[model samples]
Target: MRTTNRPASGTVQSVDRAVTILELLAVHGTAGVTQLARELGVHKSTASRLVAALERRRLVEQVEDRGHYRLGVGVLKLAGATTARLDLAQEARPVCRRLAADTGETVNLAVLSGGAVLYVDQVSGTSTLSSYNWVGQHIPIHASSNGKVLVSELDGTELTRMLGELVAYTPSTVTDRALLEDELAQVRQRGFAVATDELDVGLTAVAAPVRDAHGDVVASVSVSGPSFRFDEARIAEILPLVRTATTEISSRLAHVPPER
Candidate 1:
């Protein structure tokens, strides 16, 4: 609750405090009531109430045999809910299954939300040793194949705002805004994207954009796995399959728009 030099709007202030609390726990590992209150510039009772509210929602938890607190399972549930609420998940399930069966690699459905790609559904391939379980997680919009495919839908100004101060998630992640913008333009022209070890050290993914009836990019369909099984040639091979899956999903989605 530190006062901003320029006062924040009410909504912005609430969001800032919520994000600050999360950052505090991430950086300090564990914090007690008084210390957190002091750090946040709020009263001890107010901090306690915030902690108690977070605890009730499983976003924070009290440490055992200690007065400190840490992040809890509720955060994971909240993260998972992003995917669970998507109408695309139900509509795209059969298409994802077909893609997984054909490619023998995990098939994922993702949509762009708040400048990040949120996985809405996934179907695990029947490989002898499969990899990746990021179905209900958020990944950087500039670092993944699905991300680039979705980012292609944004206009120049909106894309620039979303890509502000990009962080490198991996050695190959494009943190340079100009370079990433160029790549996004290519993705727009090509109708697909291939990311090799851009997010994880040895992960590769091929994604195609999913468009609605009006031709707006609504989501992305991807096939992904470990680098050992997803090399350049393999990614190129799967691109067509991913495109086909996305096409099918798009056709199904065209008939059913979300209720406003």
Candidate 2:
């Protein structure tokens, strides 16, 4: 689906106020519209409208007798997804540590979030100086090895919609749509991606797709370090290890490789 920027300040404030109402309800366990309006410093009618919207989505449910609202099952469903992400991180922690140790490079677990690469976990190398922290950070989808691997399965039309501008972060960043498509094709064939100074002037990374029980690419396992030390020879040496780590992680997620 095509996305457009929110056009109105009132619309943005309405969304923010709605989220604050949810937060308030979460904290107090339950609240009436009047109390929410007082906390939000908005008119009672405004609070009612926000709560009404939330109710439509099952994010909030009204206590008909008490005239109050509480968080609904939708919140639990969202929280469950987060819990699964945490589980994935925990399960991949051992493999990330081993990869970092074996290559003396920083290792990361990332997933596609809002058309970007969200780094969920990280393991540092033996050398503290070479290690970089990126846990809980989102990077552009078109500029990183992890991002490429995550989107490798997308078809041309979907790829176009997903990557709108292909903004360049560095001189080496591939901004051409056709080139990126070609690179993604190669990534699929090789089952991995290598990005050399594509996202940053001196950063390099190699990533392998991490599949889930259904054999879907649910995440990516990447080894990243300074470009100077991540030369072609070093990359070749550790590529197998990176691939193995991803396979192990996928196995932890119950993804069984088909027997040859």
Best by TM-score: 2
TM-score of each: 0.65, 0.85
Best by lDDT: 2
Q: 27-111, model 2: which lDDT tens digit per residue?
A: 8999998999888877899989999999998999988656799999998999998998999999999999999899888899999
RMSD of 1: 11.6
TM-score of 1: 0.65
What lDDT would each prediction earn against the true structure? Answer: 0.82, 0.89
Candidate 2's displacement at residue 103, Å, is 1.1
Q: For all the candidates, what are their Cα RMSDs to the real structure? A: 11.6, 5.6
